[model samples]
Target: METILNVEGMTCGHCKAAVESAAKEVSGVTDAAVNLELGNVIVTHDDALNIGEVKQSIEDQGYDVK
Candidate 1:
């Protein structure tokens, strides 16, 4: 499964790395890609992935997921 999350406060490579790392750390997540210019995250995961958890994980990294 793939999900696109609109995220805010990403301004550089570090922000992209942090969001990707955080999303990948979530259980069931296969991969994560961030587009800093678009302020969005594209996540690939199994169907079992809890999207809410993914959002929270990103939030925990000091980002805002919408």
Candidate 2:
């Protein structure tokens, strides 16, 4: 499955890396990519992955996930 989340407060490469790292750490996630220019996070995972957990992971990195 794939999930696209709009994240706020990402303004640089570091923010992109942080968000990607957090998202990748979630169980069942296969890959994660962040587009700072678009404020979007694309997550590829299995059905077992919890969307709420993914959002929380990004939030833990100090960003707002919508």
Candidate 3:
């Protein structure tokens, strides 16, 4: 499954990397890509992945997931 999360406060390369890293660390996530320009994170994962977990992971990185 794929999940797209609308995020806020990502303004540069560091933000992009941080969000991607956080998302990828979640169990069952296969890949995570962030589009700073679009303020979104596209996450690819299996059914076992919890959407709330990914959101909280990004939130822990200091970004707000909408």
Candidate 4:
């Protein structure tokens, strides 16, 4: 499964890394890519991946997901 998350407040390399790390914490996530320029995160994961949880994780990192 693939999903794209809309993240806000990303301003640097560290912000990108933070989003990537949060997304990776989801058990079913196989891979994740973030585009700071696009303010989007593309994730590849198994069907078991709970997008809400993933989003929450990213939000916990101080970013907003829409």
TM-score of each: 0.97, 0.96, 0.96, 0.95
- What are the per-residue Cα lDDT tens digits for candidate 4 across 1-66? 899998999989999898999999988898889999999999899997779999999999999999
Candidate 1 structure lDDT: 0.95
Q: Could you tell me how far off, in angstroms, the CA of residue 41 lies in candidate 4 after the best superposition?
A: 0.4
- Candidate 3 matches the true fold with a TM-score of 0.96
Q: Write the residue-wise lDDT of candidate 1 on 1-66 in tens digits.
A: 899999999999999999999999999999999998888999999997889999999999999999
* Model 3 regions more than 4 Å off: none
Better of 1 and 4 by lDDT: 1
- TM-score of candidate 4 versus the correct structure, residues matched by position: 0.95
Over 4 Å off, model 2: none
Better of 3 and 4 by TM-score: 3
Residues 1-66, candidate 3, lDDT per residue (tens digit)?
898999999999999999999999999999999998899999999998889999999999899999
Query: Which of candidates 2 and 4 is the stronger one according to lDDT?
Result: 2
Candidate 2 residue 49 C-alpha distance from true site, Å: 0.9
Q: Model 2, 1-66: lDDT tens per residue?
A: 899999999999999999999999999999999988889999999998889999999999999998
Q: Global lDDT of each model?
A: 0.95, 0.94, 0.94, 0.92
TM-score of 2: 0.96
